[model samples]
Target: MNLAGLIFVLVTHFLAGRGVMAMFGIKENKRKTLALSMIIGVVLFHFLPVVLEVCHIAITATSISIAIGILTLALFLPVSYKLDYSVLKITRPSFTLYEALFATLLILMVIPSVWLCYYFPVFARDVLSGPEPLAEYAVREHTLINSALSVDLTSTNNHLKPPFILGLQVIYKLLVHPFGELWLSIMVCSFLLMFYTLIRERVHALIVLFIMMLFIMMPEIYGYMYIVLSDYPNMVLFFLAFYYLGKYLETKQANTFYFATFLFCLASSIRSETVVLIGLIVPLLLFSFIKDRIKPGVIALRLGILLVIPYLLYYVWMNVFVANYMHIQFNTGEQLSVTSDSVNIFFDRIGIILGPMLFSEHARELFGYIFNIFLFTLALDLVLWRKKIGLQARVMLYGIVVVLVGLPLLGAIIPWFDINNTTKRGVFKLFPLAAFYMANSPTLLQLSQAIKRFEFPELTAQKNAAPVMAQQQKIKKKK
Candidate 1:
């Protein structure tokens, strides 16, 4: 591993992302904005290589470094606009003993995950054949359209998938590590921090820690944290996209909505199938706009923005790049199941996905009790707080449905989309949403408030007395 190169790449991304957040006016607290900056930087930098390739520039170390320098300077050009250092001024919150323990446990898990990512060679078959070799050769040859494309890849279409993974791999392999997957670790850590920031504000610190523990403990999801695959990265971007979308719903902030759309575009760039899922989200966005009583023209325009961007990305990759640039005859129609029993096949796939694949003993081994906890929390909410369930929670539930149904729909349309491999990993998209919903659980929120009251009784008493004192003062004034 090129330790110095890794540090340089990470720092450049952090600073570049920080500059972007500042330029766009996407304000959060210092910590959260920092986390979001890192994530946004990772996704945005993917396009640097794409731009180079479009211009027929070789993806060499010097080229990439120069590009980074140019982008960084461009972002930080406004020297007079002071960067946000308010995080330094804010006092840190005191953690209780239990919160400290939970933090320690999460740190322990993260350390080993990073180590494993650094230690292991590229091993996933999908990656081994596709992005891994392509990236390895692209680094060696300094061109993406290299000798790797000349080989016979009749067995798998993985090579024809979007260049998002290839772009990251090329950058990382050149600048970070030989395996080029430390980007995954960067992504994982940034996402976890941002997630913590989001949830800690709404739930008790202790409960937030517990939720983070459950998230890190999921066997399938945890393994992917280190493993180099597109699914986990896709899940991270997709989840963040919706998180921002929820923020848009709450604040009606254009920047927030555009950020969500940008993340969704990044997610789509990772997997072509993501376009379908984005389509599923359109109705939700449209309904929200209607309820807000926004003009039909503006509503249509915003919905168009959400849907068009992803489709344009999809077309660039699948239609333009793959067909013209690579000269590959990649056909989606050939992958579809057109048999008379296609409907039955779709329903069967759905049943398998929601049934044994979700709840069976084997699934318990793969996912542990995470799904069970989500279902239980969801049922509890439905029974006790169904009417009280807020739009954000409902939006999460809507995402859960979109993924669950969208996967089977994809399987039905694309013959090779199997329940075991593709569908299994596709289910990763749901876990983060589940975690978000769990964070918003009303019972959990109430419990979080009770815990806070118990932990700081004096503060609670002060709060309780203030209202009473005000009432007594009013009576005295009336007399």
Candidate 2:
């Protein structure tokens, strides 16, 4: 792997959660936490030679790439698990085989049913393609995707935010065969997992499994799932973290909370910006430990210490060790990126930040901005049951608003719109949380369909209230 890629992986995967978690509630220390995260990145990445040499082995292109991913989970899971037990955090079973069955259908088949309504042409295009369309892009004898647009093996894009998709690429590289059958098989499973996590139903899972299947069936997203890219992987990882966090909230399972936090942090590395979302989980854990008054009947402080200790150690290590090892740079501007445009527009800059809103039909533009805000607020309300959820939400929303607001500022500051591949390609990464904000039941299924039909519900709760009961709609709305 390229040196930059290695560094990207370590900093992004290993330390992102710890970095973001450390900044919770502490305005003054955020930079320090970020600094520490960069440091930790150095320790993990820079130490590769030492680790490889100590084992008397040479790291392969695949092995090293694989190691970065495996190590992240290995490090996160055990410690997060211990933290749960030590904190005596609660636990509840979110799924049995049966519930998961239906959830699976909802996520897999059902969701896709809704998705197919909108992306009909995209799906039709793929279906109408040659029998070997995927073959044209399949991994070749040289161990790379056949397409000209395929990512360069030598490119230093090392941060595998959602490495699962990348792993698929590697698999195809070795298979030396068409990915047509393999694609559908994986799609089936991915849809299953997708729906199972989202709806937790096996029977229903299949319904929505194909929901986004056709949406993602678009050549760009579909191709990358079998090709080499981080989008699908990031999507899956973010979904997993969110799923686990939801489980933790529902059952108060310390295990889920710890794992969720760990996975969320781990997600930061895979996709770089998951740190913003992970930022929310850590503080909620700390506060709930200190202030929630929930009792495990024993080991309350021990659990609190457990919850805080890993984060603290990770922080100290990041700041003192990794940062020093790599001499990582920090940026405060990253935070203000969102609303920079709004503020700029507020100052009457040439370009509009809130687009047409800040002027013209000023109230309407603000309302448009507020429409997203309301979407976010509604989704937040529905999913914001757990304190950790709120914590994650705050961090995610912080970055989301930054982009929503910042692009205008960046546009104003720059002579022209920022159009680098990184800026354009990474636009989605910045809005990971925003995905959650918009995933209401109606929005996910019916409203999306309605949009295809050119309509929206006057009353939202009526449309998108999965996992949320009808009677409790008012409570969630009020919440």
Top candidate, metric lDDT: 1
Best by TM-score: 1
lDDT per residue, candidate 2, 1-479, as tens digits?
13454354534543434433332311112333343334333223323332433354443445545555555555545444323123233456555454566455445643443344223222332222311222233233221123432434233223111222333333322232223123222333433343334332211323333333323333333333333333444444455556556555555656666555554444443444444434444444556555656666533553454345435533533353334432333332443434446555434532433334322364332222333444545564567433333443454454455445444444444342443332333344333344433343333443345543443355544556654676688787898
Q: Over the full model, what C-alpha lDDT does candidate 2 score relative to the true structure?
A: 0.39
In candidate 1, stretches whose alpha carbon ends up further than 4 angstroms from where it belongs are: 76-82, 88-93
TM-score of candidate 1 relative to the true fold: 0.95
Task: Look at candidate 2 and tell me the lDDT of residue 478.
Answer: 92
lDDT of 1: 0.85
